[model samples]
Target: MLWLLMTTGKCNLVCDYCGGSFPRDVVSWSVKYDISKLKSTIETRDRSPTVIFYGGEPLMNPKFIMKTMDSLNATRWGVQTNGTAVRMLPESYWKRMNVALLSIDGREQITDKHRGKGIYKRVVENASYLKSLGVETIARMAVTMDSDIYEEVKHLVELGVFDKIHWQLNVIWSERWDFENWAEKSYLPGLEKLMDIFMQNLSQGILIKIIPFLGVISAHFTGGYRGSPCGAGYSSITVTPEGRVLSCPIAVREKWAELGTVNEFRLLEDPLPDYCKTCDVKKYCGGRCLYASNEKYWGEEGFQLVDSVTKKYLRMVISKLPEIEKLIDEGVISKSSLIYDPVQDSTEVIP
Candidate 1:
C-alpha cells in the first residue's frame, strides 16, 4: 500500500492542472496540524507501508520532510516535486529517498509556458544529480495540448537522462486544456507516433508506463477482467497538506472520502464504483473522479463531464490497442505492455 505523507502544501511553481490550491482562494502555504492526537491515531499493522512525499511540492519544507522521514520506517519513499526546489536541496536529501518522480511534461518552450522559465532546465539538472547518487529517478510526463511529446521524448532518449518515463495522456482536469485543435486529435500529431516510439524504445531498454493505457492493453489482449486497477483506495491513498486522506488524488475531496488522517485513513465500506469494477473504459478512465461523481460537487454536470472524458479517451485507447499490441507481440514493444508498475516505479534516468 502507498500513503501520501504530505509534509507541506508549499510549492515552488504553478501549472494549469492539479494544484491543491486551485479551488481555494488561499494561495500562500499554511502549516496547519491537529496533532494533539496524532500518535494515538496512528494504526499499527504487520507490514510497513510505502510513503510518498507529495506536496504543493514536497521540497518546500525540507525540515518538515526530514522530520517526517525520521518518524517513519517506510518500505519505499517517493517524492513528487517541481525539480527547482529540489535542486537547491542538499545531496544528502537525494540519497534519502528510494525514487523521485520528476515531472517533465515538455521542453523549454511548452514547459516554461506552464511551469516557468528555465524550470525544465532545472529538472534536467536535478535529475542528473539524483542519478549520480544512485537514486532511482523517473520522469512523469503530463501531456498537454501544446506539449510536443515527440521532440521532448527524443530529447530524453538523446540525453540518456531518465531510467523510466511515464506518460499521462492529457485530460481536462477542471478547465479544458486550451489549444487550437486539441479535441480534434490533429492538434498533437505525435500522440500516436510518440506512443509508438515510447513502446519501441521501452522494448529496447529501461521501463516506461503510459498509465491507464497499459491497463487497457492488459485487459483486452491479456484477458484482464473486471476493471482497470486504478489502484486508488486499494493500493494508493492521497493525503492533503492539512492531512485529509482521500481515495484517489483527483477525488481529493469527494464523497465518502477522506478515509481519516494519514495514519487512520482506511478504506470505506463502499465497493469501488462499478465504473472501476466493471466498465471496459475503467482501464482508461478509472471511473473519472469520485468527487466528480458526487452530486454536491459536480451535480449531474460533473457526472456528464466524467462520461464525456471517459468515452472520448476510451475510444482512443480501444482504437490504438491493436497497434500497441502488434508492436508488443512483434517485439517492437516491451514493458508497460508486459509489466506494469501501478506507480511503484516510473520511467526515468537512474544510472
Candidate 2:
C-alpha cells in the first residue's frame, strides 16, 4: 500500500483550482506533526512500503522531508510538488528520488492563467534542472474547460524535459459545472486529436503517456480491475499532519468520513457500490474517485460524469489496441510498454 504523508498545509502558488492550499480539500485544515513520531511510524513497517510525500508544499519543510527520508526503509519514494522549490532539496535527495510529479498545466498561458504569473517559467526551469539531474520528473496537468488538450500536449512534448505526463480534468466542484456535457463537447474531440498524435509518436518511438488512455489500456491488457478511478483508500491512504488518517487527501477535509487516526489506520472496507454491480463498465473504471462520487460534490450526475470520461478513453484504447499490438509485434514498441506499474505510479515505454 502507498502511504501519503501530508507534511503541511502551505503552498506558494494560488492556482485557480487549488485556491492556494496544499491538497486543496473541500474544508481546509493544517497541522504539523511531530517529526520523530512520523519517522518512527514509517520505520515500524515490517516490509518496505512506498511512501509519497504530499503537502501544501512538501519542500516548505525541508528538514522534515530529509529526516523522514533518512529514517524510513521505503522501497520507492515519490513526491507531488509544484516544482518551484526543487532547488532547496539536496543533491542526494534528487538522486534518491524515484518519481516526482510536478504540476504544470500544458503551456505557459494556460498554466499561468490558473497558477500565478511567471509560475510556468519557474516550473519549466525546475523540470529542466530535474532532467539534468536524471530525476524522473513527470509533468502533471489539471485540464480545465478552456484547455486545448492537443495544443497543451504538443507543448509538453516539445518541452522535452518531462519523462512522461499525467493529467486530470478539473474537478466539477461548482454546482454550475456541467462536466458530462463538457466531456462530450470539449474533452473527447481534443482527445481524438491527441490520440492521433499519440499513435504517431509511438510509431516514431516517442511515447507521450496520457493517464486515462494508458490506465485503461493497461487494465485491458493486464485484465485487472483499476481498483478505483483514484485508488483512494485501497491502494493508498493519506495521513494528516495532525495524525488523522483518511482515505484521500481531499477526504481529510471531510468531517463525517474520518476512517481512523495514524496509529489506528484501517483500509477502506466497503466493497464496490450496488450501482457498480449493474454497470457494464466497472471493469474499466473500477469506480471513480470516492470523494467525487457524491451528488453534492459532482452533482447527482457525478457517477455518470466519471463514466463518460472513462468510456471515452476505453473506446479510444479499444480502437487503437490492434495497432499498438502490431507495433509490439514489429518490435517498434515493447509489450511491456502497455503495462502500468502501480508501485512506481508510472506507465513504462521502451522506445
Candidate 3:
C-alpha cells in the first residue's frame, strides 16, 4: 500500500490554472498531525507501505515530515515538491528521501509565466542538488494549452540535471473550463512532439521519459489491471491534515472522493463503471481519472473527447514499441532502465 501524507495544503505559490484550494477539513498548519493515528493506520495494513509526501507544499511542515521519517523508518518514500524550500531541509532528510519530484513546466519563460519570477532557476538548481544527494529527481510537468513539451524537455536535457521527466495534462475542474478546444489545438500536438523526442532521446542514450506513455506500454506488457487510470483509493490513498483519507492528492478537496478516516479506513474496490465496460480503449485508459469521471466533470461530449485522446496516446506509443525494442537490441538503451509494475503505480527507472 502507498500512504500519501498531505503534510499541509499550504503552498507558497499560486499558479493560474490551479484551483488554489485545500481540503476544507484540514486544521491549521501550526497544529501537528496526530502521528499516533497515522502509525496505527500503517500498522494495520498487511503489506509494507510506501509513503509519499504531498502538498500544497509539503515542506511547509518540515518538522512533521522529518519526524514521520524517523518514527516510520520508511526508506521507500518520496516527496512531491514545488522545488522551492528544499534548501530548508537538512542533509539527513535529503539522504533519506528516495525520490523528489520537482514541478517544472517548461523553460524559464513558460515556467516563470505560470509559477512566478526565478522559479525555473530555483527548481533546476534544487533538482541538481537532489541528484548530487543521490535522490532520483524527476521533473514533473503539468501540460497545458500553452506548454511546448518537446522544447521544454529539450531544455531540461540541456541543463543536464533531472534524472527523469514525467507529465500530466492539466485538469480543469471548473464546468466552464473548455478542455475540448485546448485538446484539439495544443495538447495533442505537444504530446506528439514529446513522443517523437522521447524515442529520439532513448536512441541517443538519454534516459528522459514521459510517464503516461510508459504507463500505457507497461500495462500492455504486464497484463496488470489498468483500472481507474491510477491506484487511487486502492493501493494508493491520501490522508489530509484532519485525518480524512481520500482517493488521491487532487481528490482531497472533493467531497464525494473521500474514503474514510485513518482509524476507520475504507477501500472501495469497485470495478469499472458500466459505461466504460465496452470501450475499445478500456484496457489502455483503465478508465479516466475516477474523481473526474464523477458527475461534476462528466458529459457525453467531454467523455468522448477524453476517451479519443486516451486512445490516440495509447496508439502513438504502441506504434513506437518496435523502435524501443530495436534500441534495446542495439544496446542504445538498457532493458533494465525500463520497468513497470502497474499494481505498484510505478513506471520508473532503477536509478
Q: Evaluated with TM-score, which candidate comes out highest?
A: 2
Candidate number that wins on TM-score, 1 or 2? 2
Cα RMSD to native, each candidate? 5.1, 3.5, 3.3
Ranking of all predicted structures according to TM-score, beginning with the best and ending with the worst = 2, 3, 1
* Regions more than 4 Å wrong, model 2: 22-46, 178-181, 255-257, 346-351
Give the per-residue Cα lDDT of candidate 3 at 155: 80
- 165-256 in candidate 3: lDDT tens per residue? 66766653544456677766776677788778777778898766556776665665556444565566776788887778887667755687
Q: Which prediction has more favorable lDDT, 1 or 3?
A: 3
- TM-scores, all candidates, are 0.75, 0.88, 0.88
* Per-residue lDDT of candidate 1, residues 1-351 (tens digit): 566655565565777666434333222254455433332343364155667777667787777666666666667777877777775556776687888888887567877777767878889898898888887777777767676666766666566677656566454345543333553454235545656665565556533544444555555654443212434565567666666777665554455655776556676444346545756555444454444454333345544554655565556557866666666677766635455544364221100
The segments of candidate 1 whose C-alpha lies over 4 angstroms from its true place after superposition are 18-43, 46-48, 177-181, 187-189, 199-230, 250-256, 269-271, 274-278, 283-285, 288-337, 343-351
Tens digit of lDDT per residue, candidate 2, span 149-208?
778877887898887777777765543466667777777888898889888989977667
